[model samples]
Target: MSQGQHWREQLHEAAAQGDTASLLKVIRSAVAERADVGDYTLMSRLLKRIGRDEASRAGLRPVRVYIARSVTVESWLPYLAVEAAAAGFWLETKVGGYGSFAQELMSPEGALRDFNPDLVVFVTDVEDVAGGLPDACATGKPELVRAEVERGVKTMEDMLTAFRHHHRARLLVQGLCVPDPPVLGDAGDANWEASESRATQRINEQIAALCRRLGDAAFFDENRLASRFGKARWRDERMFRYCRLSIAAEFFAPYARALTHSIKVLFLPPHKVLCTDLDNTLWGGIVGEDKPSGILTGTDFPGNCYRTYQRYLKQLAARGILLAVVSKNNEKDVREAFRVRAQDLALTLDDFISLKISWQDKAVSLRELAQELSLGLDSFVLIDDDSVECEAVRQQVPGVLVIQAPREEPWRLTECVMASGAFDTLSVTAEDRARSDEYRAQAQRAQLENRAASREEFLASLQIVCRFISALEAPLSRTVQLINKTNQFNLTTRRYGTSEVESFAADPGGLALALRARDRFGDAGVIGIALCRTQDGTCTIDTLLLSCRVIGRGIESALLWYIARWAASLGANRLAGEYIPTAKNQPCADFYPRHGFRPAREAGGKQSRICYVLDLATQMPEKPAWIQTEEDLNNEPGPSCARVNEEFAR
Candidate 1:
C-alpha cells in the first residue's frame, strides 16, 4: 500500500484505540502530503469519543452547550463542535428535538434543565416567527405593518423571558434568514417599503435591543449569512417542506462555522497581540535589499496589496490588539522607511509597541516580544509569509498561533486573517481599546523600575492611584471584562456574564466593586473587581480578581485593604474569602493567607478549597502610602443598579 493509505490505516487504528496523539499525527501527515482530509467524519468521531480530551490537551475546558432549533440539527452539530476546536473551545453539545425549544425550556423538568447548559442557542427562522408575511397589497398603511411585527416580536420576547427565568444559560437567538426567492418575489422589498421584508427586519432589530436590555442575550445574524451564501443555494425545498430543515446540508459547513465562531467568541478569549514580519509580509519586498523607495508599496501595482494589508493590520491595532514587528532585517533600514517616507506607508513606527529587527529566528523574536509585553505565548498571533518561519514557530512555540500570509495574491492576506475568526468579539470594553496604550506604559514603568534605588521608592515615585467604586456605579462592561480575562490574580476563577454580575449586585447585602488604576506611566482601565455577599453582618468574598498586568505592584493588597474598610462602613464586622486553586491560578494559591486572612474551612479532597476569615472591626487595614485610594461617586450608575436593589445616594 502507498504511504497515504498506510496513514489512513493508522488513523483508523488510532480512532479505534482512542489515541489523541496518533490522531493528531495523522492529521498533520495529511497536511504535509497536500492531500484532502475528506469530510472530517473520522476526526469528529474521534473527538466525540474523547469528549473533553481536546480541552485538557489544549489547556482549555469545553463549553457545555445545549442547542434548541425549530428543525433537526443533530446531523450538523458535530461539524460545529469540530469548528469550535479551532477557537480553543471543545463544545460538549446537546440538541433538542424539532420545534421543542419553548416547551423544553419553559417546562420545569425538561431536558434543557437536566443538561444545565452554559450556552443555549435558539436557531429559528422567519417561518417560525411570522405567521406568513402580512399582505402588503392589502394595506399600504405602515400602522398595519407595525402592528404585525410587534405581535411576532412579542412571541419571541415571551419565550426569552421563560428561558431567562428557567436557566442561567447565555441565550443566543439566531436572526431570521431571508426565505428562498423571498415568497413575495423581487417585489418583496420593492420601493423600499415591502411590509413582509420590513417586518422581518424590525423583528431582528427588536431582538438585538432585547439582548442589550437583558444584558445576557445575543443575536447571531443568520439572515446575512443566508444572503451571502445565496438564498437559492441555502434552501432545499424538498428538505424544508418534507423534513422541515431550513438550512440545506451543503450549506451546513459554513453555517456551522458561523455558529461555532459566535459561540467560541463568547467563551474563548481573543488574541492580545499581532506579530508580523517586516519584509515581504508587511510590504511587497524586503527592505534590507530593496531600498525604501524601490520597495513595492503605496498606491501602485503589487504595492497596493501590501498597503491594503497594512491598513487592515492598522485597523486591528486601533481596536487594541498590540502590534509588533519581528523581521530578519537591519533595524536602520526599517527605521529609515518608517521615519523619512512614512506618508507612503499605511503603518508607522508608532503603530508597533515593540520592534525586533534582527537576524534571530522568528520563534526567538516572538518569545522576546511576549516577554517584553508580559503576555502569554497563547495570546500572540504570528503572521509571516515565509512557510519556514510559520512552521518553526509552530514547532518551537506550541501555544503561539501562526498565520501564514498568502504570497500569490498579497491582497488576499486580510481575507485569510479575517476568515480565521480569531479577532471577532461580541463586546469591546474600554480596557480593550486602551490595551495598546497600557502596554506602552508598562514598558516605561519597567525603565523607571530599573533606575529606582528601592522597590518602595519606585512605586512611590510612580504615584499609582486606585479608584474603588460599586460595579453598579462603575463601568459594568469593563468590570465583566476583567473578571473573565483575569486568571493568575483571580482567587476563585469563577467567570460571570454581565447579567450575572448585575444579579449579584442586586441581591440584598450583595456588594460588587470595580477598581480602576492609573500610574505616572498611564491609565489601566478597570483592572480589578470584588464581589461579596453580606448576611447577618458578615461579608463573604465571592470573587476578588485583578488583571495580571496590574499585579506585583501591591495593587492586590491595596484592593483587599480597601475591601475591609468598605465592608466595615457597610456595618459588616466579619469578612470571608476563599482560595480555589486551578491550573492557571497557581500564583494566587496563598493569596488569602498572605494578606492576614486566617483559614476558616477546607474541603474537596484533591481539588482542595480553603476558606479564610477576617474580623473587619478588629482589623483596620490601611491602604499603602504609595498608592492613593478613593471611592468614585461622580459617574452615573450603570444599568446593573437599575434593578430592585437598594440604590445608594451620594
Candidate 2:
C-alpha cells in the first residue's frame, strides 16, 4: 500500500475510536507536508465526537445547540457540531426529527423547550421558501413574486414568535440558497423584475428584514455559500429527491464551516485586537529600504492591493477592532510613511491603537501590546507575511492567532483576513464607528496625565461632563455594545443582546441609564451603562459597567453615585449590587467595597454571587468635585424614567 493510503487508514482508525489528539496530529502532519487531508466529513465527525466527550467532562462547558431544518440533515450534523468546536465551543447538540421544524417550534410542550438549547438553528432552502414561484417559461408577474416573498417571510416570523414565546434562545435562521437552473435562461441574473431568481432574492431580503425586526434573530446567508462553491456543485438533485438534503453531501463540510464562523461571532465573546506587520504585509515594500514614497501603496497593481488591504483594516478599526503595528521597521520611518509620505494611504498613524515598530521580536511586541491595551493575549490576531514571525508568535505568545498575509497578490490579503471571521460583528453601533477617534482621544488624555502636576489638577482641568440619559432616549445600539464589550470594570460581566437591552428599558420596575462623557479633550461617546431594578423601597443595581478606556478617571464612582441619587429619587431606602467573579474582572472584585456599598447577604450557593447594599436613607453617595452632571435636554427621558422620578418626588 502507498504511504498516503497508510496515513488515511490510521486517520480512519483514530476517528473511529474518538481519539481527537491523534486525529489532530495526523491533520497537522498532513498540513506540514502540504498533503491533502482527504474526506473532511470523516475528520469533522471525529471532532464532533471528541467535543461531545469533552463537554460531558467537568469544567468544559458546551454551547447547547439545536438544529431544526425542513429537510434531512442527519448526515451533516456531525460536521456542523465539529465546526462549532473549532470556533471555541463544545456542542451539546440535538437534531430535530426529520421535517419536524414546525412541530418542534410551535408545539407548546415540545422537546425543544425541554432540551433548552442556547442557540437554535432554522435551516431551509429555496424549495421551501419560494417553492410557489411560477415556472421560468411562464411569464411571471411582479405581484406574484411579491406575494411569494411575503408568504416566506410570514412563515419565518411564525417560527421566531414561537421560539421567543417559549424560550429566549438566540435564533440563527439560514436563508434560502440561490436556486439552480436559472428560470429565465441566463437573463434572470440581470432581470430583477419578473423572474424566479428575483422571487428567491425577494424572499431572502424579506427574511433579513424580519430578523432585524425581531432584533435577536440573525440571518445566515447561504446564497453566498452557493456562490462560493457554485450552485451546480453545492446542490445535488439526487439527494434532494431521495433523501431531502438541502445541500449536497460533498459540500456539507464547507457549509457547516461558514455557518460556524457566523455562529462564533454572534454568540461568543469576540476578539478585540488585530496585530499586523508593516513591511510586505500592510504595504508593498520595506519602508526603510524603499524610502517613504518608494513604498508601493496606491493606484497600481501590487500597490493598489496593499491600498485596498489597508482600507479594509481601517474599516475593521472603525468597527471596534483595535489595530496595533508590530514590525521590525524603524519607528521614525514608519510614522513618517503614514504621516507624510503615504498621502493616499487608507490607514493613518492615528488609526492604530498601539504602535510597536522596532527591530525586537514580534512575540515580545505582541505581549507588550496586549498589556498596554489591557486585553488578554488570546484577544489578538497577528497578521504577517513572514512564516518565521508567524511561527514565533504562535510558539512564544501561544494565545494569539496567526494569519499569514498573502505575498503574491496583495488584494487577496483582505480575503484571507475576512475568511478568519475574527472581526465579524453582529450589530454595528455608533461607538463602534467612533472607536478610532476615541482611541486618539485616549492618547491625548494620556499626554495630559503625564503633564499634569497631580491627579486632582488633571481631573479639574479636563472639565468633565457626565450626562445621564435614559436607555430608551439614548442610542440602544451603543448601550448594548458597551454591555457586551466592556470587561475590566464591569460589575457583573453580563452580556445582553439588543432585545434584552430594550426589554430592560421597558421594564416598569427597571431603568436603564446610559452615561455619556466628554471633557476638554473630546467626547468619549457612551462609556458607561447602569441598569437598575427597583421594587418596594429597595433598588438593585442589575448591571453597572464602564468602558476600560474611561476607567481610572473615577467614572465608576460617578456612575455609582448617580445610580444612588436616582434610586433615592425613586423612594428607595437601599441600593443593592453584586460582584460576579470572572478571570478578567479581578480589577472590579473590590469595586463594591471601594464605593459606599456595604456587604449584604450572599446569594447562590457557595457565595458564587457576592451581594452588596447601600442605605439610601442616609446621605447620597458623593460624586467627585471634578465631575459635572446634567440631564440630556435634546432627548427627553423615557416614560419609565419620568415615572420613577415622579414617584420619588411624591
Candidate 3:
C-alpha cells in the first residue's frame, strides 16, 4: 500500500481502539506530520472523554480558554483545540452564552468567573456591539465615527476591568472586522469621510489601544485575517443563517490558527535568536561561487525576493531577535562579499550577533554559538535552504527549531518562518529594541574578560553597577516577561502574569524589587526580580529569578545582598527561600546555600521542594566586592548588613 494509505490505516485503527493513550499519540504524530486540519477535527471528537488534568501528565501543558463571542462558536471549538494543541497545550474550553458576552464578562458570579481560564478571549465584531455603525457611516460625519469608537471601547474596557478584578487570565481581544464589499458601495470610498472601511479601522485602533492600556492584554486583528483570506469567502451565509456562525466552515482551521497564534506568543516562551544560512538562503547565489559581486540581490526578478528577505531580517533584529550567520562557507569569502559589495547588499557586517562561517558541522557550530551567546540551544530557531543540513541539525541538536526553506520557492521562506511562529512574543519593549546592540556589547565584554589574567581581576576591571528599584516603579511588562521566561538562575521556577505582579507590588505587607544592571559595556535592562512577603517576624521569598544573559556576572549576588538588607530594614529577623526543581533549573539548585542560607530543618522539606532559611538579624551575606551597588553611593545609610559570611552568591 502507499505511505498515505498506511498512515490513514493507522489513524483509523487508533480511533477505533477507544483509548486516551492511542488517541493522543496519533493526534500528536498527525500534527507533526502536517496532516489536514479536518483529520484533527474528527480526532478531537474522542477528546471529550480524556481528562484535562490527565493530559498534563501525558506530556502536554493543560490550559483552559474562555471564548466569549456574540456569534455561535460551538462548531469552531474543535478547530481551536487542535490548533492550540500544536503549541504543546491541551485545551479545555468554556463558551460564554450567545449574545450575552457583556453580561457574562462583567458579572462576578457568572460562568466566566467560575471557569478560571488561563486566557480570556473576546471574539467580537462591529455588528455585535455597534450595529448602528453602518448607519453612522452612511451619514458623512466624522463625529459619529468618533462617538461609536468611544462608546464601543469604553464598554469593552469596563467589562475587561471588571473581569480582571476576579481573575489573572491574560486577555486576547479580537478587533472590529470591516465587512468585505463596503456597506455603502463605491461612493463610500470617495473620501476618508465617507469610507466605511476607514470608520471600522478607527474602531480597531481604539480596541488595540485599549488592550495596551489594559496591560498584559493582546489584540488580534480579525479584519486583517479576513482580508488575507478572500474577503468575499470569509463567511458563509448558510452557516450564519443556521447557527449564527461568524466565519465559513471551510476556513475554520485558518480562523482558529489566527486566534491560537496570538495565544502562543502571549503564553509561550519565545526563541531569542534566529540563526540563518547564507548560501542561497540569504541571497540567490553562494558567496564563494558568485565572487562577491555576482550574487543576485538587487531589484530584479528573483533578486528582489532575496533583497526583500534581507530587509525583513533587519526588521526582526530591530525587534530584539538576534541574527546570526550559520553557513558552510569560507570566512574570507563571506567577509569579502559584505566588505566589498556593500552598495549591492541591504545587510551589513555588523547586523549579526555571531557569524559561524567554516567547514564545521552546522550542529557543532550551533552549540558553540549558544555557548558564546550564553543561551540555551532551545532558545534558537534555524532557517536554512538546504534540507540535508536542516535534518542534520534537527537530529543532532533536537532542541533547536529548524525551518527548512525549500530551494524551489526561495521567495516563500519568510512566509514559512512566519507560519512556524518561532519568534512570536507577547510584546516588544525598548529593551527588546536594544537587544542586538546589547549582545554586541557582550562580545566586547568577552574580549575584556579574555584579556584579564584572573577572574576577580576581570570582574573588577568591568566596573559593573547594579540598580535596585521598587517593582511598582519598574515596568511591569518587562518584570513579568523575566518572571515567565527566566529559568536557569531562577530559585522557584514559578511563572506569573502581570495582574499577580501588580498585586504583589501594591501589597502593604509585601516587598517587590527589580534589579537593573549596567557596566562599561552596556545596560542590561531589568535582569532580575525578587518577590517577598513579610508576615510576623519573617520575610519569605516567593520568587527570585535572574536572566541567563547576566547569569555568571555576580548580578544575582548584588541583588541578594540588597534584598537581605531591605528585609532587615523592614524589622524582619528571619528570611525564607524555596527551591523547586525542574529539568532546566539544575544551575540554581545550590543558589540559596551559596548565599549563606542553611537548610531549614524545622520546616519539613518534601522530595520535590526544598526550604532554606537565613537569619536576618545575624548572618548577612557578603556582597561581591567588584560590583558597585546603588546603595553604596548613597549619602544616606538607610540600612546595613548585620553580618558577613564566606559564601558566594554565584
Candidate 4:
C-alpha cells in the first residue's frame, strides 16, 4: 500500500477505536500532510464531531469566525474550520443567511452580531457588485463603470458602518473576482471600461482603500487567489445551478487555505525572525565548493532566480521580519562572497541580525540566535534547501517552523516561502518598517553592554528614553497589537479585540497607557500597555504587558512609576494589581511583589490568582533615573507631534 493510504488507514483506525492520544497524533500528522480535498473534508467533519474541543484544550487558540456572505458558503465552512485548525486556531464559524447579508448586517437583532465573532469575514462574490450594473451600460463608458463603483463602495460603507456600530470584530473583506467571461469579451482587455476584469480589479482596489480607512479591516485578494488557483478550474456550473455555489466543491479547500492565511494573523503574530541557510538556499551553489567568484547569484539563468529569491527576503526584512544566518560554513568565506558580489547582491551582510556560520547544528545555532535576540524558539522560521537539514531541525527544534527551499527549481523558492504563511500579517505599521534597523541597534547595544564596567554604567551609558502616550492619545493599532501579542512579562495575558481596546480608550473610568522606549541605539516602538480602571478610590491594573523585546530594560519600571503617579493624581488611595498564572508568564509571576505591592488573600485563598495592592500615598515604584521619561498625556494636542502637557513627564 502507498504511504498516504497507510497513514489514512491508521488515522481511521485510531478514530474508530476512540483512542484520543492516537487520534491527536494522527491528526497532527494529517494536517501537515498533502491530502486530497475529499480526505480533508472527511478529516474535517470528524474533527468537528470529535476533536475540536479536545484540540482547544490541547492549546489551539479558539476563534469565533462569522462569514457574512450572499453566496452558498455552508459547503465551504468545513474547509475554513479545517485550515484554521491546522494554523493553531479552533474556529467556530457562523454563516449568515444566503443572499441576505445586507439585512443581516443592518438589522438590530442580527445573527452576525449575536455570534460575536473574533473576526467577521465578508466573502465578496462578483454578484455583490456587478449585479448593480445597468443592462445597457457599455463597458467602454467610464461613467457607467464609475457609477457602479460608487454604488458598490457606498453600499459596502453603509454595511460596514452598521456592522461597526455594534461590533469591533476585525474585518476580512474578500476582494470581488471577475465572472467566468469578460463583459466585453474580445475588447475586454482594452481599458478599465472595456473589461469586467478591469472593473472588478478597480473595485477591489477601492475596497482595499476603504478597509485601510477602517483601521481594523483587511482586504483578502480573491482576484489574485482565483488567478493563482486558475479561475477555469474553480467554477462549477452544475453546483451553481443546484445551489448558489460560486466556488467549486473541490476548490473550497484551496479557498479555505487562502482564508486561513489571512485569518491566522488575527489570532497569532507572525514568526519574528527568519533563519536562512547560506549556501544553495540563498545562492545557486555551495559557497565552500563554488568559491566567492563561482557562486551563482548574479543576473544569469539560475543565478537570476536566486537573486530574485534574495530580493523576496529583502522585502520581508523591510516588513519587520528579522533575518538570521544559520549555516554550516566559514563566516569569512560568506563575508567575502557578499563583498565580492556587492554590485549584483540584493542583501548585505548587515541585513542579518545573527550569523551562526560556525560548523554547528542549525538547531543549536537557532537556539543561540534565540537567546542572543532575547526571543523564544517559537518566534523563528528557518528555510534551507536541504531536506535532511530541514527534517533534522524539525526533529530537534520543533518550535521553529522549517521550510525546505526547492533545491534545483530556484524559481519556486520565493513562492514556496511566501506560501508557508510564517510571516503573514494584516498590516504593516511604521514600526514594522523600522524593525530590522531596531534589531540591528539592539545588537549594537549588546556589544556596548559587554564592554560596560557595571550595570549602572551600562544603564547610564544607554541614555534610554521612555515616552508615554495616553490610551486616548496612543495609536489603537499598536496598543491592541501589543496587548494581544505580549505573553511573557505580562501580569495577565488578557487578549483584547480592537473594539475592546477602543472602548478602554473611550471610557472615562479606565486608564490605559502605552509606552514607547528608545535608547541611544534606536527607537523601540510602543512596547508596553497597562490597562487600568479606577473605582472607590482605588486603581486596579487589569492588564500589564510588556513586549518581550523591551521587558528586561528599565522601561517597565518607569511605566509602573508613571501609572502610580497618574493614579495618585486621580485621588486613588491604593494601587491594585493581579497576577494570573499562565504557562508562559513565569517571567512575570512576581511582577507585583517586585514593584512593592503586598499580596492580598482571596475568600477561598485561591493560589491560581495572586492579587496585590499598594497604598498610592505610601508606596510608589521608583522610576529609573537613568531613563529620561516623557509624556504627551491625556490632554488633547494639535494635529502634530507637539506634546500638549509635558508637566507629567518629570
Candidate 2 residue lDDT tens string, 68-129: 88788777776666555555566677888766787897776778988988888888766665
What's the TM-score of each model vs. the native?
Answer: 0.90, 0.87, 0.91, 0.92
lDDT against true structure, model 1? 0.76
List the candidate 3 regions with Cα displacement exceeding 4 Å: 1-34, 46-54, 57-59, 139-146, 190-194, 601-607, 631-650
Candidate-wise lDDT, in order: 0.76, 0.76, 0.79, 0.78
Task: Show the lowest summed lDDT stretch of 10 residues, model 4.
Answer: 636-645
- Give the per-residue lDDT digits (tens) of candidate 3, residues 68-167: 8888888878877877775667888999887789888777777887888888898876777667777777686778867876676677778778877666
Lowest lDDT sum, 10 consecutive residues, model 2, at 30-39
List model 1 lDDT by residue over 91-162, tens digit each: 788888777877876776789989988999998767677664556324666776677677778878888877
Tell me model 2's lDDT, rounded to 2 decimals.
Answer: 0.76
Ranking according to TM-score, highest score first: 4, 3, 1, 2
Please give the TM-score that candidate 4 achieves against the real structure: 0.92
Better of 1 and 2 by lDDT: 1
Q: lDDT for model 3, on a 0 to 1 scale? A: 0.79
Error of 3 at 520 (Å): 1.1
Candidate 3 residue 610 C-alpha distance from true site, Å: 1.0
- Model 3: what TM-score? 0.91
